[model samples]
Target: MNTIHTHFRLSYKIYDEAFALSQAAQCHLYLSLSQKAIRFAVVDTARNKFVVLEDYELITVFTPLQVAEQLRLIAQENALLQVQNWKLVRVAVSNQQFTLVPETLYDPVHQFDYLRLHADLNPLQHEVYTYRHSGLEAINIFAVESGVRLALQGVFENQPLQLVHQTSALIRSILHVVPRNNLRSMYAFVERSYLTLLVVGPAGLEFCNVFHYTSPEDFIYYILFVMEEQKMNPEQETITLWGDITHDSSLFNILQKYVRQIKLGKKPEDVEYSYKFHDMFDHRYFELYSLHLCE
Candidate 1:
């Protein structure tokens, strides 16, 4: 059989957040190619009360008929309720760069990876999971650790970017580092003692970010203080910070710092799982909400 060897992906048209609706008006949208379509959209302003104008674009190497058939399956699963200001925008993407496999391929890989990774951790002290994944344009920097895993493009709007430069810089600044390479001081004790996750953004916007602090305590206390001052509890029930303060401001560095804190406070006692999901606050998650669109 002749094959196209084409890449596949599903682009979605997500509309504006609609006004709060009644329970009857609540709706969800999803897509499927094989047997069951997965639930991808759910407008739960209250309890599944709001709806939005969204559609799914299926990309594939299959014939047009195959694609249309898949679309029918999807529509049958999710009937078109109504219409709104939704436009179908065709974006030319370089599938060559990425495998661009059907999300069906990635979701399972991601799921298994998540469960397997979850099984191996310190459990006590380390109990959090969040990382800023790289955009489709660039690869993320978190594939090296035995205990760590990538959260990837899902952390934010499924856009190519999980963390924008401005958002990244905001995280860096919020951590209180000046972003200087030479200035970053890494104590040997800390390096030998902790795991590291370095987060890099385009310089100066590019890599000009460089700075160092006296101790990991400076960064740790700052984060704790920020949480406390803001009157918000750090989401994770327990935190373990096992790394040194005087290190790079990359995601790895910041995480190591936080891990050290977790160890000091939460002992991770009686937790079934040993793996920890350490995630950091990427300012972009909030910053992008403000802009509400790609510029």
Candidate 2:
């Protein structure tokens, strides 16, 4: 199947050329893969800013082989001839089978068994990966099909790259920007077909889950349900949103009806961005941009 590729050049000059030649350049390549699409970014760590960003949508869900081919195509098209010295390369997968476990209760020896109990995946067929939250004393455990991991690894076999599961990246992004004093606040990272709801309270991360919705009603149902379950009053609690949603979108409009303090999330305050990024919606690429901040 042919991949539909869209490239957006924010800078007037080709940043890759300068990135390739500059010995002082601290460049990192980041990728986020989902069932339906792939998003990639190149960040100049020396400047603490993004230089190039692109999004590619597959015509249909991709098989492992197809994804590998696309990755190879991306590497070639981007002209990344010298990836050996890259500051870092990271990839995050957007799969839903993930669970968070308290740090004290987590054991590496039984990691697979613990995850299998909560997520329905064959232990033999999937590879388990864990990420620890910096601020909270909890661990995020998730799995990806072994084939998918191998395919992604094979693409960068010659280079040093790290693979991160989506749950970790999502949680990391929220932790980086979510206000610490906000005793009652909910964050919804809205995507095209799914939304990740995170509830934070005085104790810590109170609730975290991903819900798939086909309509506006379904979307609001999950949001309101989380609020109700978490004892968060919509009239007083704030709902901060990020990802592919806009103020004029139906999803946002429906959410406005029930939530009084609805606001769009901004990029992490620690990172710097070029003037070119101002043209795009700040909330649209939270995950992709947050990859730079992920440890």
Candidate 3:
């Protein structure tokens, strides 16, 4: 399905036989992002142009006609290619429900919540960077789009906190700079963005919540409440959370539990070439990386 992942970039796998891709698509273990499994898709490496948001598909809540309509609308803004094939699969997250996100309004922070994550690193070149979250006073929203960034401002424990994205990269092949000292150089390649809330008072920055909740119901309710408290409509909010599949996080299950149409973050690309379906989503990461149902 077309996933609007919160904590991931583009990932791909190669396919050998077309049938292999088909088989992979049918595997019951497709819902990799659950408390039960970590859904992962491999890219068709042979066609190596992965851009994280090139193309996407919906498996659980969409019908063939719906997919067609979605593609048609997307075509309204830009030319699009057709999926190679299509499949009927069900990803049932136990104790989970789903909801429909509004089609037009966009709350950038909620939309890119995942971008506000633990440090994202690029190892090939050994890059690393971290994003800190704090509520920005509505007055300072403009600072967010400015180019002067090294660290970012956020609300921590109800106070101001700052995170740096580094101004530049400095790598030295000779002299004293080694791989370990390539902080500036490595971070140069890391993609950077952050989510901040606007809560400014005469006093400085302050917004931290170290202790929230632990149970499934409490979690979902909390998240929903947070959204509502921020005056964000649950109907308009699209909550797509992605995390390491290994942890067995009940977070996804809880989220799916509350909403009417929760979107999972799995892709047909993860399947082996033989398992992948022909009419599945476009394998280009760039096209599907940010496919949001946000209206």
Candidate 4:
């Protein structure tokens, strides 16, 4: 019997000529799941280089089950995602239901308590989880929708897998490339309706949080609010942006109006990328690419 499957829109995709389905066992699979999109990338562990990347923009989905359905459709059509023989599978869930706790104060037994302080959680629908940042000595407390979590677990039932929040991945990636000068800098991971802002300094990750905005004004307002709260000067401090934004974008225009040093971040340099990805924007897919850096 032929089952009809509706697929999400593919926003961007790149594959190296050397990539092959037969090499799944020798590579790592990274999936970044969010309310508005699901992006996945493949890395050739043998050479420590990225070989495949695909981004799918999902239709508006309100429930966890609806997001799971969209994921299933994309997996059914994606040859790379259908394989279960990857050397490692890491999934990063992107949402606002997350918080950062200092390592010394983190209590695994109280994961729910740590996260509930920052966001409300529906025990039946959302599962609280924690990812330890070894380098920064912190614990990331976040929630994942049960349906989506179950769907991914079912997909790679026997394969080695790890799950983390998208903000965790972004923080890991940002710290990896934080300037040697150790200057306090603001990093913004922009999405369609939200952005994850992080302030990293010489000591390590100082602040991390997600903000939802509807317009350009709302976007800059949050940026400036964070700056004022952190005592960062708009005319002197630098803010580097990444993810779903461009130089000519209205969001960028508004950002430049207030911030003096506005820079577009590049992909992580710690890992290599296939030449096919050379033409792609460096700042885009910062979370998806950073999954490779996650344990």
Candidate 5:
């Protein structure tokens, strides 16, 4: 169905003016898709700020075709076509499967073989995308269903858009905020149906993986298991969390019992947000805001 869990407009005046001057102004559009919702933002690159941000949550499970129809409807509702000549159009997808490999051994020609070791591959039906982690000397290989990729392409037909796995955005965003000096720390980005856990140590990125869970118990199990696997002490190591979770969320409540140093993640300090966004939690829409930093 067409159910929207929540939607917000941060600066209508700026958005209207930006669209009206689309030909002269430099703008960037960012879209993020998760299993349960689609979120987008429009940024005025010249002003170095966000003009509009919105999200639509789905109540019914959507197939690729249905998701495409919904994406088109959302674009129409937001008058996305009114804005032209985007400085950049970046889309991040979180519903697909991904794996990490060292950059030294990465081979673009054999990408499918590398992914097949960790996930099933339908060579004819899935499209593989790779993102290089320059700092960590690793490359992230991910797959998105060709149908979904085509649907996304149709949403911005004829427009130049950079498609990337959501994990890349997550990694970029976390690195932007996480202190380099913190010898041991973990970051978790909780979405509707999945959570991504990233572990960092003095050496560098220690571990990173995504887990799907249906309940708070399942969520904490994965967190605790990761801590155990990494030899991290919950009593001392901090776990900074972002995305759809809150202090009062069941996931948070359960996590507190096992991890003493849990903290809420903050938005990237490098970007400026409008005062109109004051009502919303700072940690929310982190990946959306971080899209501006995506090269």
Candidate 6:
């Protein structure tokens, strides 16, 4: 129940007293998958509350195929993931193979073309997918590994499933929680060694991109670089942090040294969480929890 494979370790888990396998028909399942980790959350739609959450950390880097194999093992062993009667299922893929295009200009036939500008495509290993963000008036064109996509589909064969990029979920949840008073700000969503940065203003989303870093220096460098390019004054503007970081962590410490106003982001305000979730960091599992906001 704790480890799916030798590499996939159950970092933590939380379950509400109200959660029951028999009530899956009234619940929604959200999954976040990446080379570094895989996590999932279950929400009871009837009460608009999260009932269960689990985080699995990969001890070492995994190829898409390896991740798929671990996911298969997880599906076979995890009781919650085995249920197919859920009201909704959404899986968010966290990776660098994604780009955003204006909704007005998006063409279904050219999804591949749009993504090619940002990432190389391998038909044998990757599959192209797109998600429309109505609130932001944009289309997120992304690639998911064929192996991972197939594994997810096979697990939920009897139910409808929506696959989205991790950024989509982050954007939806951040927009919902960030004050919309026309104040521009920066937000960071951290994962293993990957960092996703977003700049929002009165008009809407200004800039969004992801970076891969190996050290705290690399992490802070990207933030400063983006802020300069976006004409944001780090001294005056606020930068909010979420996912895989702590106030005392090296990442946070390095960021605080350069940015004048840095704060930790909270969970999405629109949804409710069970009391059991209070013990976990509110900013962690943000992308997974925000899957509820994805259409």
- Which candidate tops TM-score? 6
lDDT of all predictions: 0.27, 0.75, 0.26, 0.88, 0.77, 0.89
Given candidate 2, what's the lDDT at residue 17? 41
lDDT for each residue of candidate 2 in 253-292, tens digit (9 for 90 to 100): 9999999998888887787766666777778778888787
Model with the higher TM-score, candidate 3 or 6: 6
178-292 per-residue lDDT for model 4 (tens digits): 8756689999999988889999888888889899999999999999999999999999998999999998999999999999999899999988999999998899889988898
Per-candidate TM equals: 0.21, 0.87, 0.24, 0.96, 0.89, 0.96
Choose the strongest candidate by lDDT: 6
TM-score of 1: 0.21
Q: Per-residue lDDT for 1-295 in model 3, tens only? A: 9643222222434333432434422322111112211122223334332211122323332222233233334333322112222122111111111111222332444432322232232234221222222222211111122111111111012222232211100001011122233121100101101111111123322221211344656556655665556564555444432222112456555555565444323332322333343344332221122111000
lDDT of 1 by residue, 113-169 (tens): 443342342333222222332322221111112111121211112223222222222
Off by over 4 Å in 6: 1-5
lDDT of 6 by residue, 1-295 (tens): 7554567889899999878999999999999998888899999999999989988887665587878878887888899889989898899998999999998999999999899999989878889999999987899999999889889988998887999999998998888887777789999999878999999998878899999999999999999999999998988989998999998889989888889998888888778999999988788889988898888
Candidate 5 residue lDDT tens string, 1-295: 9553323222322234444434424778888876577788787777677767777775564454455555666666566644546667888888547888999999899998899898877888788998887887888898877877887676667678788788888887777677678488999988976898999776667888889899999999999999999898888888999899988889999999999987788878777666666667777888898787777
Judged by lDDT against the true structure, how good is candidate 4?
Answer: 0.88
Q: How many backbone clashes does candidate 6 have?
A: 0
Residue 246 of candidate 1: its Cα lDDT? 25
Q: Rank by lDDT, descending?
A: 6, 4, 5, 2, 1, 3
* C-alpha root-mean-square deviation, each candidate: 18.8, 3.6, 21.7, 1.9, 3.6, 2.4
**Residue 163, candidate 4: C-alpha displacement in angstroms:** 0.4
Summing lDDT over every window of 10 consecutive residues in candidate 1, give the lowest-scoring window. Answer: 88-97
Instruction: Output candidate 3 Cα RMSD.
Output: 21.7
